[model samples]
Target chain A: MASEIVVDKLVKRFGHATAVDAISFSVDQRETVGLLGPNGAGKTTTMRILAGLSPADGGTVQLAGLDARTQGREVRRLLGVVTQQDGLDVEISVRENLTVYGYLCGLSRQASATRADAVLTFFGLEGRANDEVDALSGGMKRRLAIARAWMTRPRIIILDEPSTGLDPHSRARVWENLAELKAGGVTVLMSTHYMEEAAVLCDRVAIMDRGRILALGPPRALIAEHAGRGAIEIRCDEAQRDAVRAALTAIAVPWREMGAVFSLPDEGADLGPVATLAGVQVHHRPAHLEDVFLRLTGKELVDD
Target chain B: MTEFRLRSVAGVVERHRVATVRTWKVALTWFLIEPAFVLVAMGSGVGQLVVEIPGHGPYSHFVTPGIIIGMVMFHALFDSAWGVFNRIQQGAFETQLTAPVTVTELAAGEALWGGIRGVISTLAIGGLAILLGWFPLSALPVTLLVSFVVGVQFGVVGLCSASASPSMSALTLVFTVMATPLFFFSGSFFPLEVLPDWVEPLAWIAPLTPGVHLARGLAEHSLDLSHALCALYLVAFTLLLFPVAARMLRARLVK
Candidate 1:
């Protein structure tokens, strides 16, 4: 499939600090790609450049085969961007917000109205069309933001942390809407901190750290490559650490320590000896994207 | 390969129109009542105390044009500075930027909207002047045209300031140190000739002075060479500042 988006060695700098280093990636048509990273990992900067909201300091971006640097207006026309910040016009009605954005996207007044209605219904916000956006709940506002982006019927949608602050139910609703978009074969590029969200929604996940992509692949593929099928976790205090390490070494299993817990690959390795060790608890489960992320980016908390 | 469209500006102007309509009560207070109060207090009350000026006829007539120009200046300044700043902070411009709208289009639309508003407010004060028979009816169109030019000029200036302002309080400093001082010293109330020798150069450099000169000349139907030069200076200044304003706003917004 032809790539709908291509970013080559994208770089962004804020004064002396480089926000996005020489990072490159692509999204195929009808494919969903996730930029998975912690805060200040340059995910938002990359998305902003792809969405034509910011300029790249070095490298090039192509959207639907058009150069983003020189053809920003055209790139924007083909993209529907939902930024991390809610961009809804609080002074306007929910429907009006979408309609006005549609008009800005070059739709006629009549077409804008129709598109607004369709998006409102799509986001399950038809009943609140006439209500002021400021009066809507946070979740509803997010839905409105997405619906407004959808109003343009863009071929590619870029969402920056689409479900960052939503509750479980609202996040589920957002996922359902995104799922619908996926079912309709819309190209999606999203940045997320939620490992589950990326695992569920992304066809390919690009794990990012600092200002570069550390790994990129399918969720299952990354887990298998970086974390194996499953892991045996041994939790023990400092006093019991030596006993646990000796037990794992005697069993000939490779183990890595993260804080108070030690993780070993679950390659049919006998954990009976480690489990039998006193003052240590064992947990065995399938490896997940979170584990891969932790392995790639370390367990230290990324300061916002 | 992508073709840029020109229709995006109408969308931005429409959005501003809708927002203005939604807040018509506040808009009316600023566009109409505030100017009326200034006209009454300065043109009428202050007019009563001052005797007849040398070149200008009556106090009320001499200051009427100044008050009208001040209205346009204030409206354009506030709309482009505080209004643009608030919209930027609220991500309003970002939302539009995400669409097919270019930064130049956004800046032009804002400047045009400010001019339209200045014209509307000018009409309000012009109507009052006509009702009271304070100025000649023949110069109404010219006065309004001058008011629009002043609007665009100051609108661009305001956007330039807004682009550099880091916070709302920083904008307060702009209003205090820049706008307030310009408002008082720009020959809006009395002639610049009455000021001290050192202040004459400052008044000459004030952005509002040429606008005041053109407005007063057109209002009184006394378009002399100096007033004509002032009008030319305003036209040249607007043409120069508009692109600068657009570039500055683009830098601040596109990041």
Candidate 2:
């Protein structure tokens, strides 16, 4: 499949601080790519640059085969961008929000109305069509935002943290809507902090930190390569933590600590010796993207 | 298939129109009521105290044109400054940018919308003036044209301020520092000749001065070289400020 989006050596700087630094990636047509990162990891910056909302300091972005820098109008016509901020016109009705945006995107009145109704129905917002956006629930507002994005029937949809603040149920509903879009073969590029969201929705995940992509591949492949087969998590008291570490080290097993929990790969590790350590509770689970993400981006707290 | 072409300015105008429709009663009330108060207080009350000048007619007649022009200035300033500021801060412009609209187009559209508001306010005041027999029916078109130019000029100026303003309070500071002085010094309430020598020069340099002169000349049917020169000045100022506003807003928004 031809690539729907291609970003090469993308760089963005805010005064003296670099926001996005020489990041490169691509998404095939209809492929959902998740930009997985901590806060201030440049995910939103990269999405903004791709959407032509902000200019890249260095590097090029090609959207649907058009140069984003030079052909921004044409590029924008093919893209539906949902920023991290809720960009809904609050005074307008949910239906009017979509319809007006449709008009802005060059849809004829009839066509815009039709598309608005379709997307409203698709997002399960048909019942609230006349309701003001400010009156809607947070999840409904998010769905409306996404529905507005889809109003243009864009070839590529760029969502910046689409479910950042929603409750789990709302997030699940949003995910279902996105899953339906993916089923319809719409190309999606979303930035997310939820490891499970990326795991469930993304065909490929790019782990980014400190303005650069540290790793990129399918979620399962990344997990398998970075996290090994499984992990044994041990929570232990502060005093016994040293003893448990020494015991694990003596057993020659690779391990890492995050707060009270210590994680070790489950490959031929002798758990009997480590389990006997004082004040330690051990639980085993299959390796996943969270492990891979921590392995790539590290467990350091990102300030913003 | 339905044709899809980029109509950035039209889109902005449409958005404004939708918003205005919902709030037009309040807008129309202010547009009509405020000017009535200003005209009654300054035109009738102030006119009673001052004798007529040699060239200009009654003080009421002389100040009516300035009041009309001042209406444009005030509307344009508030529309572009507070209006643009709210849209930018609320992420409305960001949403618009997601479409095929460029920042330049957005600025132009907003300026044009401000001009539309100015035209609406001018029509309201002009219609009242014609009914009261203070303004001739013949001068309506020219006065409106001048009002529109003034609108676009100050609209662009206001948008430029809005682009640089850091917060709502910063916008308030702009109104207080920049607009208030222009309002008082633009000869809307009194002639510039009454001011001190140094202050008269500052009044001449104020953006609203040329607009006042042109609007007054058109309303009074007193066409002259100075009136033509004032028109030229307003046109030049508008042309210069349009691109400046667009570039400044683009820099603020697209960065």
The TM-scores, one per candidate, come to: 0.91, 0.92
Checking candidate 2 for backbone clashes, the offending pairs are none
Candidate 2: which stretches are off by over 4 Å?
A236-277, A300-304, B1-6, B51-54
Candidate 2 docks at the CAPRI level of medium
Scored by Cα lDDT, where does model 1 land?
0.86
Instruction: Using lDDT, give the best candidate's number.
Output: 1
**Window of ten residues with lowest summed lDDT in model 2 chain B:** B1-10
Question: Native contacts retained by model 2, as a fraction?
Answer: 0.61
Model 2, residue A81: C-alpha shift (Å): 0.6
lDDT score at residue A238, model 2, on the 0-100 scale = 82
Tens-digit lDDT track of model 2 for A1-304: 8999999999999999999999999999999999998898999999999999898999999999999988888898988889888788875678888878888788887899998888999999999998878899999989988998899888999999999889999999999999999999899999998889999999999999989999999999998898877778999998888888788789876667777788766666678877887778999899887778666654632334
Predicted structure 2: lDDT: 0.85
DockQ of candidate 2 compared with the true complex: 0.64
* Candidate 1 wrong stretches, greater than 4 Å: A233-280, A300-304, B1-6
| Cα lDDT of model 1 by residue, B1-255, tens digit | 433345877888888787788789998898888888888887779888996778898888888888788888888888899988888888878998998888888888888777887898889887887777776777789888988998888888888988989999989877889878888888888999999999898898688899888888887777779987888888899899988998999889888
Residue A22: error of model 1 in Å? 2.6
**Candidate 1 global TM-score:** 0.91
In candidate 1, what fraction of native interface contacts survive? 0.74
Q: List, residue by residue over A215-273, the lDDT tens digit for candidate 1.
A: 99999999999888687788998888988888878987666677779876567877887
